[model samples]
Target: MTALPLTALPTARPDGCPFDPPRELAALRAGHPVSRMTYPDGHEGWLVTGYGPVRAVLADPRFSSRYELMHFPIPGGPEGTLPPAPVGDMTGIDAPEHTRYRRLLAGRFTARRMRLLTERVEEITAEHLEAMAHGGTETDLVTAFAQPVPALVICELLGVPFADRETFQRHVHTLMSLDVSPEDRVAAVTGMHRYMLDLVCTKRAAPTDDLLGDLTASDLTDEELAGLGGFLLGAGLDTTANMLAHGTFALLTHPEQLAALRADPDLAESAAEELMRYLSVAHTMVRVALEDVELDGRTIKAGETVTLSVEAANRDPERFADPDTLDIRRKATGQLGFGHGIHQCLGAQLARVEMCVALPALVRRFPALRLAVPAAEVPLRTGMNVYGVHRLPVALA
Candidate 1:
């Protein structure tokens, strides 16, 4: 295959951070709404940043998510712009297949169902706070608070033995880290696959009333079950962990907002929405044009990759007035934090419930909390899948 020309694609940023593509995306939106570009992995694809185009690509079933598994059709990646092999296979399938697999687990992730886990989420958050205090007020929240909350929550939800959490959590971090090699990532994925396989078999032998057990009883093949279980484990762990860490950092840094949230616990939902908007954690949503489609006056040929900049769309000036400033009271009418259309995050309700419970509990538990390291001194995991602080060192009040 001939190398795609860089004539139209913008220059690659030095770091090539996926999480913080907001800036470069801004430039793309302003200069070329539907620009041709090469992805970090060196695959050639169309970068669609405008509000209308991004929404169109995401909502249309004509744009498939299946192409994400194979080598991306771009230039500059390890395999000359090919899509890297995925750890699991669910992310790359289409339609009724995607629909059926997603449905098998939908009942477990509903907002009402997730609500049942609130007390437990708050209990875990409080226990972590007490542990942080005993360990000394000055502690790394990422390790002490942020990471464990979601890790424990997801573990309990999946009915995975708490003893296995250390192993699973470690793999989740390595698998999601952009700095890690693709081979290491594939290893992590395989490890998780083995874990899920063992879990399913164990559940079959001694079924429990948990999500995984229910999945075992479903009319799904082992491959389908593995795809669904692997998908849930990864989806539940990485994104929520980032949210806890990033949301905490965002709140702590913005003292007024933090105070507001602390003062009124009800603000947690709105605060979470605002934080999701501001942080815009997941960098972009990948899609393949199922067929030739016209979007915002640009013709996207069938089979081309269309990368929707979710972070960019969330902050689009045309969509949100004064989008840069974070405002909790503001209504998050159409923010795609959980995405949109058929493939929107199934665990979104659970994630929000966890956040709503955890945030208020953290502040109420430690009213005098303040950062041990200065805000600027805190190292951010920049340009990655889930942007967050590496460590949130804090002294409990």
Candidate 2:
């Protein structure tokens, strides 16, 4: 088969449309779900935009998630590129090595275990909502509520001191940001590793009742433990925080949907799923083919990168009816928001718990919640890997 024209990824969303995937991505998926695209660095690769193909590729063992194997799909030079994930960062490692860490940690994040954290999540949500109620009539939800709720939850689960949140959060911000210098990114990563190393050592001496402490029973070394701790901390913090902030923005802007959720608190679970599907923040992921493999009739050669547009896939019309619409009542099962397959998000349930507890609690607490600024003026985190707002100023009228 002749290859599709090699074009750059269509990453630009329509002006003023925050909840939708990039317009070009949707168009591309509709026509050529798998098409050749040139990365910013000028490497030609495949872009999978369809729901089935994206999910299939994510599940396929032939596709490699190793960081060193992928080419950056987004534009920018050396600064935009990230080196391979460090030792114990499970996201970058393939099976066996990846399976080892995953096995030790997966037991800790089981549905039953996560459900056990519901009461604690409720407490955290209530505390933040209460603080917001009295702190001011108007404030940035991202800072005061969205960011901190999950931040605190992760602290409790990881046994990290909540007081030192600013230290880790700032470092995480550096690590996730596209604007920072390599030096600063390295510094943030190094700083986090050092902090986690000290904590891991402490945990080794006297285990606490937390995820890291639980892992001490495993044969992981101090360096590996430190890396995993930092990795887990960074993973837990930013993604869900953005989801809350972005989900709130999505709900408030769509009044009927917001009203549906507010009128029925029981809608929280589906509402969180709908929000995740609607705002696919961790929009794009890459997987390089390990060898020649047939996918949807096309052969993806080994070492050629395939950018999986899960954001576009989530909105695929075939899989989702009126996929662009935000309907909280819709049963959003199989949404690729947390992704699919072996490398699916480790903390997906915890994130779901955070979103389900925090987003609805936020709305219920401030029945009169609204955007303090015009929706247009609210800043978007377009530059970062995580899609969300920088500040979601809201009036708890």
Candidate 3:
């Protein structure tokens, strides 16, 4: 019998190709699509790189998102099985359990609701753009604009104190960091849980008008509420924050698309979608097979993990025509940056509204905006779960 080709997961994009997924991932997608992969912990699994296989796996009920069922993909971590998904961490648990929490929250994040939130998003965008415009000709866009807009919006939506933004954001970065140790990850999550539990208690006593407050009307316990709120805030803040920052970086680098957005702010909607497809900042999605499954000509055994390179799948030439290009006009619907099926990002519409409003506003507000540092000097979040620029310094004029 022939031995299967083996490869390790590729985390870092090649130099000078920050917008691209690791070249090896693309090669695998084109050639292997689904191939044998060795996880850092020495568990051999499957790597699904092409669009077809990735979507199939994500949409399949046989693949489980349960935290305890999977192996950590990161090179170094605690050497043991994970606990079951905490009370309300929808991302780590499969439905009908995920369905209950998702059904409760999905209505609030619907298109109509998000569209209503657009007014507030516009207000926040304007505030940050104004601050950036007046603050200085040069500043880190990440600190000044990208981070705050979504952070503030999510806080307002979730009834979190904007004053506590610094606290949670710090913890979130640690959770998302691939290089962070197991002890640090636990500590950060512990801190977030403590803060969120206190916040949930406050919301329960007073019942402010926001998602958390609304959820408080349900029968969920303080611990469940805390986990859910922390989960929601991390979902709402970190991904959108980096998308804004890194999307801005992508636009600034892709001069033509940037020009298009500045010319017609209406293009922001499509541009945001295209950017999500092109950049795919939340690049990896993990699932473990609950039973033996044949996918794309490969047999994935029961209990083996299948790591999906969303970045690679999004760029699969078969699924997306000229997939590598950053074309703001492309109809980028059905892109899997938000994943597929039940576990798809619940806050996706909210993110769309934020990105549509903020990205164009930033481009138009600073017509002469350019990187304050060289392209290479701007730091990339290469080692983090979220793929983006860590610091984006820009000159606004």
Candidate 4:
């Protein structure tokens, strides 16, 4: 077999087509499913673009998710050896440790448990929509609607005071920002850490009826509880916020599809799924090979890093027909939107509940809703870890 080309990690998306993954990734997936990759640190690695290969790598135990074991792919990202993930940051660890955290948190986020939050999510969504309408016709959906709905829901779930959301939201924005100075990032993280630590202590003294309150009963140490609180807060807030913001941008740009969704409110669930598959807010993830593993006709040697192009994998033509087009009616089951396998997103169900309620509600509330600015002019979160819109300017009818 001819050797595949060695492409650099972090390819750019096509100019003007913000919904699609980097065209280079789509091209690679069409021909070479598995190809050689050169990391920013000059370390040779592997990039998996096909849906099959990407899923296999994520599910395989031989591919370690430990932060210290993997090399950072993006330029100017953390270099050299990184510390192990703290308690509750399951994404950076594997097996028994991750299993432990998953088992403990899984019960709290099950389909049934998350379903209980559906009513509350709807209430939050309605409250935000009302607030937006009261504010005016023209508004930035990111600040007014997208950001607060999830922030408030997650806050209520974790038992954090709703009054303090602004502080945490600012910190999360800074922490997730790709262009923020290292100093700013460090300060954002530290501030959040301090806040979570204090919250954990409060829960210990007066355990309420929230997630943190319930966790206080567990045998987990204070440090672990604090770390876990921060983990949940960041995970629950940033991911869904991006989804809401970016999903709205996508719908406004695709007017035909948006009209279909508006006409049939029942399409909310599938529409959310399709948006997740299309946008793929969490665009990239990495894993390090623990040993020589044969995969898709290529050998991933021990200690080698593999970058999974989630955006590419979700859009693989082999997996979905006409993968580039945004069709809300498409039965987009099995899309790796929230990922797959053991490290799949823990809050997937809750996110679905939020989107299922929010999107349809927004469109239905304002029958004449439309974009306030040119679709191309809307700012995109190009460099952030979470792919989304910086601001979704909308004209509420």
**Tens-digit per-residue lDDT, 219-260, candidate 2:** 999999999999999999999999999999998899999898
Off by over 4 Å in 4: none
Answer with 1 or 3, whichever has the higher lDDT: 3
lDDT of each: 0.72, 0.88, 0.89, 0.88
lDDT digits (tens) for residues 45-92 of candidate 4: 888899999999888999999988888777777766556775667789
Compared with the true structure, what per-residue lDDT tens digits does model 3 show for residues 1-397? 2224664687767888789898888878877889888777788888889999999999999999998988877676544456677667898998888888888888888999899999999999999888887898899999998899999999999999999999999999998898887789889989999999999999889998899999999978899899999999988889998999999999899999899999998898899899999999999999999999999867899999888999999998898899999999999888999999899999999999999999988888889999999898888888888888889999897
What's the true lDDT of residue 371 in model 3? 92
Residue 169 error for model 1, in Å? 1.8
TM-score for all predictions? 0.90, 0.97, 0.97, 0.97
Deviation in angstroms for 280 in model 2? 0.4
TM-score of 3: 0.97
In model 1, the runs with Cα more than 4 Å from the true position are: 1-22, 40-43, 68-77, 80-89
Evaluated at residue 326, the lDDT of candidate 3 is 94
Q: Lowest-scoring 10 consecutive residues by lDDT in candidate 3?
A: 1-10
Q: What is the lDDT of residue 269 in candidate 2?
A: 94
Q: Relative to the unseen true structure, what is the C-alpha lDDT of residue 152 in candidate 4, on a scale of 0 to 100?
A: 93
